[model samples]
Target: MPSYLSPGVYPRETDFSFYVKQISTSSAAMVGVAEKGPINKPTLVTSWEQFLKTFGGYINEGYLAYAARAFFDNGGSVLYVCRVAHYADPTDRNTLSGQKAAAKLVSQMDMYLLNGDPDPLPPQEVYDVFAINEGIWANRLEVQIENVGLSGGTFLLSVIYKGETVERFTDVSSDENATDFVELRVNGVSDYITIHDIWEPVGDTGMGTPRGGTYALSGGENGVVDMADSDYIGDPSQHTGLFAFDEVDALNLLMVPGVTTVPVINAGIGYAESRKDLLFIADAPPMLEPLDVVNFRKGQGTYTHAAFNSSYAALYYPWLEISDPVTAQKKNIPPSGAVAGCCARSDQKTHVWWAPAGIDRGRIFNALTVAYKTSRGERDVLYPEGINTIAVFPDTGINIWGQKTLQSQPSAVDRVNVRRLMMYIEEAISESSRFVVFEPNNPQTWRALGRLINPFLQDIKEKGGLYDYAFQCDEETNTPVVIDRNEMMARVFVKPTKTAEFIELNFILSGTGAVFSELIP
Candidate 1:
């Protein structure tokens, strides 16, 4: 056949139709084959122990393998795996399910809280006023209308309903500022009461605005923020701060990535035999250090667990798992829980937080308040609106804010010494609204201010950089910001620069001095 292929057009060769018969069909083609494991097992079984877990949790159910195989057999072309955690705890439910069991227990708890009514505990019936009356389709947000006060005189209102300052107004009707007054805004946000309910002066016994033992804190201006790094009271910083150390021991409980150390604060009151945490908890323990044993006692079943989120105030506001100003500022007693124990106050800026002034001076709030300066004259006001927030300068020399008792009057009155210190901040080169920052060429001062502002303004503002940082800018610069001791003095002497009320803007350029906030580890 090879020689016959030369004559296809004119000369005839062997017929092509006979060629298929000569060549075997089976031997005609060659194909590559993929290898597989020795043959027959169908389903892959996985042991419970084979499941992956992390951080006291299970991640893989192993059903993924079967799904993957099925998908491979079907039309699923390709897929990728996403790591995850099993949110549902599959402990034990037996014939039922673990989730069902947990759900049953939780439902029973809800039922118990429901007391007898369809609503959960019938809102506890503690003189409820106004909350969204939502957050609960079938439950209610128990509210208390307390600390209503007069501003100028007619009938201003201090409307506190369900953990919020709904509104505040200046009652210019009467010349005197009434201590207790509540004006209900009929149509606004917390429209709990009416104009008629605004000024109902019941009596002193019934109307005396609750004060934390009438102890208003005040402190002279110190140009530095307050900082507290208390680990174990018997540890190091407590000795430097001259705070009392007894009762609760220090702990390494609180920890962050780079920061490791926490103050173990003891709540004074506890059950006769039982309590939470290794250290005992109580409303107030005797011979306490940082603050007076005064507590705005709380009653049973009153406060929610959302208030304890703040590490500093967790001991006093044990019921709060949330760090809201409204809940943190409230006064407390025995079961009614309030951390009236400690504070950081300057004549200008006073911050009230929860760490009680107990024997464990190593406590965060305790360390902060003790080192904080107390005013000889008036308080230093930082922001125009009442300050409901607090921050510590990590490795900074000072701690700010403390056991502050707010007045029923809109303008907070310090029952204890309170001040906010700002330090070694770069001074204003000129008198304009803005200025350049001094380079931290001096390593000592660099570390001083550098340590002072961290964990707070780390990403936002570097230690020594361009002073012109817009609130939301992401650029880094090398401008200097000087500590205007004069500005601090001005805050003490002149009225707050910005406010809805009157305007009083004066400058104290001379005689202003710089202060340092020291935090000894």
Candidate 2:
């Protein structure tokens, strides 16, 4: 209330309809190789077209692009893509460094094609330009500079790719202080190439240099030099590889396309466990047999990392055959991306407590077939070991057949939906209950805490997220002795609805024409 100096009437505003915040559960993160994007940077892409515009289309070296396509094709809404590449050489720097080297003024015409090195440094001044990203895709870029008779060292610059002019800059200058200076105009504007250097033409006679025409760029390398485990794990300090996703918020799912190594899998599983809300969707190695997959889950023979299992991780078997958008050829790739998409779609259509598996929710898009079709008995072996199966039906298409987590124990958390529901509830309530901190440690505060959490649990129950739930924050749970230590406690009990993984039907044959009333009874 404001200080009412000689006031007759005053009103106050108070909010009473507070509820739990809706924590996002459909957000997913993936880390892998890309041809042309900022390396080791997590870029948010909401649609397939946006992903294509930012990261380009599919390439043979990495399956991240294909996975992203599958994700969007199956109704996924949010994705954070992290691009990682193995730099083959030290010369593979970003556009800024290359531009600084090119900015060194000199008079030279000693020409070097893109990626063609050993060209002599220009004695005269010229501007050297390079592609904006590090990859072979830069080979398609070319720049054209023309002297348009503008005063004060002004000129016209055009950027071209694959015979099409993409960008045009008019009245640009070599003067660094000018408003339309070439570097200032193009550094953040041009998507294709950056101005690398500015130097004098070798034969310039002061009547203004010739147009200088067009120069095609080369020497761009994909930098995918045989990825190792360390490349995928990445450095947290440098924010490379998987650590690139540290910038993303509310990422509840993690997937690494085309990477199934033991160390990488262990790292991902451990990371999910650390986050407590993230679920790891694991992809099996390509060309492995069903028995091999079972053995892999058992951590036997050449397969490992199964020992690092938790309720946070779930493994899917067999690759998928989908047509390549670029080549239009059928190719087999990992199923982790499509599985992630199905999880997100399930969370969108139903609650996160609902299983993402089964015929209705597990349909994958752009899939032609599974690489290895498993039999009922094979899945019977795989499911108990916490390995989900991707099976192909005669008319129903490919479906995710199992829903168990990688927690190889006989606990309720082994079920995917139950585990996810618990995580969802914990995150939601934990965020909503922060107001209870530092309040009066009396019955009023305890009751208030219960009042805040009970409604959230009740909402979940109403939405079928839980079969039953109980929230306790009373005197018995937060006693006087406990309060004396400046500690408050709340206990939550939940019975999550389990999916019907197995069904049994019994039939008893009776004499023909037996009494219908007796049979009904």
The TM-scores of all predictions, comma-separated, are 0.15, 0.87
Model 2's C-alpha root-mean-square deviation from the true structure amounts to: 5.5
Residue 222 Cα positional deviation in candidate 1, in Å, after optimal superposition: 43
Please list the C-alpha lDDT of all candidates, in the order they appear: 0.21, 0.79
User: Which candidate number has the best lDDT?
Assistant: 2
Give the runs in model 1 whose Cα sits over 4 Å from its true position: 1-231, 234-521
Candidate 1's TM-score reads 0.15
Residues 386-474 of candidate 1: C-alpha lDDT, one tens digit per residue: 22212234454222233332222332122111111011011111121121135323334333333333322332133222222222211
What lDDT tens digits, residue by residue, belong to model 2 across residues 1-521? 46878959777785445578999998999998887887777889999898887888888888999899888887798999887776433233231111110112222134454685777544444566778877777788777777644346667788887799989988777666568767899888887777744443343232222245676788777667666676677766666767777777688889998898888888888878877888888998899988888777778877644464689999998899987777788899899889989999999889899999888888887899999999998998888888899999998899999888889777899988988888888898888888878988887877777777889989889998888988788788878899899999889999888888899997888898898788886
**TM-score of model 2 (CA atoms):** 0.87
Name the 10 consecutive residues with the lowest summed lDDT in model 1. Answer: 25-34
User: Residue 121 deviation, candidate 1, in Å?
Assistant: 71
Alpha carbon lDDT at 484, candidate 1: 29
